[model samples]
Target chain A: MTLLITIFAAVICTVIWYKTAPKNEMKVGILCWMYWGASLMWFVDAIIEYAELGAEFFTPETADMINDSYLGLSVVALGLIIWLVILLVSDPKGVVRAALTNKK
Target chain B: MACFLIPAAEAVITTVAAKIIKAKEEKDNGNLSLTDIKTDDTPKLTFSRKLGWLNKLLWGGSALLAFEHIWHGEVVPYFPFLTAVQEGETAAMLAEMGSAGVLMAVLITTVWLGMLGVSYIIEKRPDKASDTAEETQ
Candidate 1:
């Protein structure tokens, strides 16, 4: 569940990054890379567990799946929060900078 | 139990490496314009900048995984740090670190390498186009 969620985020972010590839003023690629890296890590973890548990891996408990979905949502939210912080700090659009300097 | 430790450790090392490489690249900036990724004729992408990408991925992923482990009670705020190790489930924890932990780190690195390759192709494309145009002229 975590893997699927992260992969979804990665794909969406990658498309956005590609569209703004040349300028990249927002640094969207940073978030995309984070998601992609995490997706790959989760993929490895899932593969390893599947190897150990065989068919049982696919038959996870309902409660466990529910828990995983919550965790996945949390991970996605955390990524967004981090990206938001970066955007504010970098002020790619100059919105934050202008607000601070009282510019129109 | 402490699977995130491996990548966290790698992150620390790479963070240091990225700083040193970035410093070196800055030192070379006087000899070349290091502000552009356009690759008009020569690709300005440097090793340090590439390392920065890897460092961010490692650090961000490790941090998220660490938080997840803590949420699951696998990690703790106290001494010994890992709940499994504190309870003497050392063998299982070590086994996880050895297999899943190592594989996760390795796969992330391989993916980063693939990213670098793709970036190289993108950065190289403009230069190739300009060369063909010059040859025709």
Candidate 2:
């Protein structure tokens, strides 16, 4: 499936980046945070969607609740992405720099 | 988890691929003597290496999510919606959901792979030799 291929490709690219990054830069840290945030949001969204799908549709209210939950989680995910972008812009240095320099 | 396993598998493949490329480059350049040399003077990756850890983190997150979904969501109750629907509709819905999950995984992995590809290209830049030599001393 396209999904499998894309996921496989993403892993390759990430490893390549890891191997090639500068010891002094902080960009990698920001990216890591962003990835974690996105993953959390995605997990939440998936759970909500799965829950909605599996439950019996006894009432319209239940459907609406699931929809609202999905929307809310999406907003949260968007917020995480925005925050990551800010972190990325604020410190152009890779996070590795902070750890290294902290020793000095 | 599929996310981590898939990527780890890909990394092994990449290493193999890299070796093949290196071998080919050596053959073309007539530099068998230079093949075993590992130089730190490689050019900088356009993307940072810190990004690599994200894959592990995401994989962990997904595993947790799977656990939560199975334990908290209760697997048996989770799929009952299928039975509630018309007989013909259940299979289609399940298929659709499965497809969506696959798509999401692929999208995330693709971005990860793109970062790696960029890093490789940047690191191979010819200018890093001076930097490498300087670092060696």
Candidate 3:
């Protein structure tokens, strides 16, 4: 479930990024990359867990799904945090810079 | 908690960095006035700016999710992490969180695209006005 969420987010971000590739003012490419990276991580996790759980993997208890959801949200949050850091560092629009500099 | 803290910390750091950059710019050119710094003066929309909207959506969604987790007492302040949900609870969690997560993602994307549409119309208006003016002249 976690993997599915991340993959879905990645796809959405990617499609938007691709359509606006020429203008990319918001630097969504970074977000696309982040989601894709997370999707890949979750994919590997799912594969490993599936191998370990075998038949049991298909029948995840209610608690497991909830936990997975939490994990998925965590991953998504972490990716956003990383992207925020990148945006601040780059200051592409210079809003932060302008805000800090403007004495008025 | 970390989820919330991470973005907060980034905001602080970015502000500080902006201050430093501002200071440097001031020092390099004495005539550089604060009022002169117009961040929105980009004549055309750039790809990065469009992505910025998406970034904002992600931030908002993440913050909401973190708060929700905190409310549910699912947040833990330790390293190997929060209480492990029992096997029986997995199905319930999946049903609830799965739907919620999907809904949040869809809502964010929809809002973003809506904003984009509005911006396109707003951006084009000026051009249209200018074209009309030119025709009249």
Q: B56-110 in candidate 2: lDDT tens per residue?
A: 4444334333333332332334445233143455555555445544454555566
The candidate maximizing lDDT is: 1
DockQ score for model 1, please?
Answer: 0.69
Clashes of each: 0, 13, 23
Please give each candidate's TM-score.
0.87, 0.34, 0.43
Query: Looking at model 1 chain B, which ten-residue stretch has the lowest summed lDDT?
Result: B31-40
Where is the poorest 10-residue window by lDDT in model 3 chain B?
B1-10
| CAPRI-style grade of the A/B interface in model 2 | incorrect
Query: Taking the tens digit of each residue's C-alpha lDDT, what string does model 3 give over B1-137?
Result: 22333333333454465556656666655746442333354244543355554555455435444544554566655643433343245555545444444444444456567778987787655566667999999
**Candidate 1 vs. true structure, TM-score:** 0.87
TM-score of chain B of each: 0.82, 0.40, 0.54
Ranking by lDDT: 1, 3, 2
Error of 3 at B32 (Å): 29
> Residue by residue across A46-98, what tens digits does model 3's lDDT show?
56568788989888889978887877777677767877888888998999899
lDDT of candidate 1 over A1-104, digit per residue (tens)? 88889899989999999999989998888788778777877788888788889999998999999999899999989999888898889888898877889955
What's the lDDT for all of these models?
0.82, 0.45, 0.59
lDDT of 2 by residue, A1-104 (tens): 11122233335435655876755243444334334424543543455455787654333476566654554344334434644666555655556457667965
Arranged by DockQ with the best first, the candidates are 1, 2, 3
Evaluated at residue B116, the lDDT of candidate 3 is 85
Residue-pair clash count for candidate 1 = 0
Hey, what RMSD does candidate 3 come out at? 13.8
